[model samples]
Target: MTSQTTLIVASPSAAGRHYECRRHVTCAMDDAWWKSSRHRMSQVIKCRFLPPARRKRLAAAGTEYWKSQARKYCDFCKCWLADNKISVSFHENGKRHKENVKKHISQLSKRSAKEFKQKEKLDDEMKKMEKAAMAAYLKDIQNNADLTSQELNDILSNGEGSSKLVLVPAPEKVPVWHEVKSESGNYYWNTETNETTWDCPEVYLSLAEQEEQKLKKQENEKAKERLKQEQQKDVYKEVNARLAREKMKEKAVKQPELIKNKSTYTSTFGPAERATKPYGSWTPVVNKPQEKVDLQLPKSSKEPIPVPVVYEPETPRIEFNEKKVESLGEGPVEFKKRKFNNHIKRNMRQKTDDD
Candidate 1:
């Protein structure tokens, strides 16, 4: 009889005796054991599991199984079916198949609404062209008809009774505003429509009149601007006149004295007198004689005589007195002396007071 054995694995970290059995064998399932022998056994078992041709056949069968389960929709016939129904219909002949063909043909033959709109637009354009051609024919006939130079000028200039037209200028539009008195005692113009609160209708009428007046004022300003631009061609004349007047006024106000002096000098010594004078002489001289002259001398009873005063020299006075020698601090000492230089000096000495 042959014996059948079962392999048992254990981790190397377990500390136990190896168990022996008649039917099964146990071994440590450690990394060393796998590297030694079990790893090769795993590779051999994996290789025996599936071959290359079997794997390919298995992959193809799986794809086919998935496709058999997928949902199917017929867009042309507008229907949904399972795989079984799809295969059965593909094998069978039905009206749906013919309808799909007709549907595609109809899609190819049908025109869109956009193309119809374009065709209608083109028809309108052709009608307009026909009308224009008719108008041009009538215009050419009218142009060939008899027409005077005055008539032609009238038409060109858009005069009265000519076929040519003149566009009338549009009337100015003024905004009508409602007047409202606020709590602050100020009036404001309200653009929104509202019920009239005032007792007198004349107030609203007057407000409208005020708005019209404002619009007229704006028009007048525009007209004034146009006139001013037209007058700019001769602006220098007005500017020069204004500047001359300003200069004259400024000179009169700022230099009145100078103007007066110049006027008086000119009147006193005018160009006429200057022209009459010789070229070398510019100044004028006037001569006047003395009013009176007196030739008088001082009167003396006796003739004045020169006198010489003679005086005997004073006798030299010598007096011997006991002299006292005073001892003062060692320093420069000064002495006082009497002087008689003039009468003014004597008066000054008498008027001075010593402190």
Candidate 2:
């Protein structure tokens, strides 16, 4: 029997050289070769495979590093990469990748919508709770002695109700009337007649209330009349002021020199009055001349009057030919026959009868 030892490669294959082996034997678990081989395999596996989370972190770090380097291409894959670090890989064109991206977008949209709905629901619930709390507080207050049920009902339902305590005072007793004259120095009370010329009650209202009512009534009436008068005065003043301003403007526009001496009554009134009058005084009048003495008839001439040669106006001649007459164009034409003269008388027959 021959004894053999196993060898394990620790580092990367050094200087590619083959060694002669006496036997191909498996090493025991406690052997140094097995331990070294296991350690080396663990390291190789760790370098070959990475967890998903760690891979993502490493990829993110690599993107950041690439961004800092400002490289246009990936160092590992030797492919073009965007500055945003979106993978320009064959996976991006895969159906599964596209589906995953769409699913992520849909999930984000659904999450936002759910959050918004939840906020609205929370606001509505808060408002309802506030209303309920207010109602309970109001009920509690109404249950206390400070406010009555009727008052609370009135406030809630907007209904009018009488108060428990009356505020108005009772009517006062009627005062005694006396008829005492101002001239009488002594005051007298009459029992049977009860009729006098003075000291009668003018009004039956309480002193203070009567004075206030009278003053208010008088003030109201006076204010109404004053307002009416003020309105009328304002209207008249506005009309007069407008007319005056218009007249001043017209004077300024038409006669600027009159505006300089406008303070003088002559300048203000003279031109205005002159312009208002008729222009007959500024017009010139013409007189007609008398005719000479050709009105008398001339004396008769001794020689026979020669025939007066008068040239008469010529009349327009019109010739009518019956053969040229035509019928009306639109309707059917109708013709009427004419009767001709046939009988003739001779003047020689009367001389033969007398012979």
Q: What is the C-alpha lDDT profile of model 2 across 1-355, one tens digit per residue?
A: 3333322222222222112222334334455634454452432221121223433554565421110222245333344444444555554675766777777789899999999999999798667656655655575576685666657787867634545565898786544433332332323233344432223355333445546768988999999999998986775565556557658877778787766768755545344554555655566688879778686887777976789999999999999867654855888778986545523345444335554
* lDDT agreement of model 1 with the native: 0.53
lDDT of each residue in 1-355, candidate 1, tens digit only: 2333332222222222111122333345455754555442332221111223433554565421111134456566666555466564783357776778787777766756668889999798667656655554565567775445557777768755546576999996644444554433423343455322323333343556777889989999999999987775455455455557658877888797776667444445535554465666666687888687666877889987989889999999999999787976799888987666654753454655768
Candidate 2, superposed: residue stretches over 4 Å from native: 1-88, 93-95, 142-355
lDDT of each: 0.53, 0.51
How many clashes show up per model? 1, 0
Lowest lDDT sum, 10 consecutive residues, model 1, at 43-52
What is the TM-score of each predicted model, taking all chains together?
0.16, 0.18
RMSD of each candidate relative to the true structure: 43.6, 44.6
For model 2, where is the 10-residue window of minimal lDDT?
A: 62-71
lDDT of 2 at 242: 54
TM-score of 1: 0.16
TM-score of model 2 relative to the true fold?
0.18
Give the top-scoring candidate (lDDT). 1
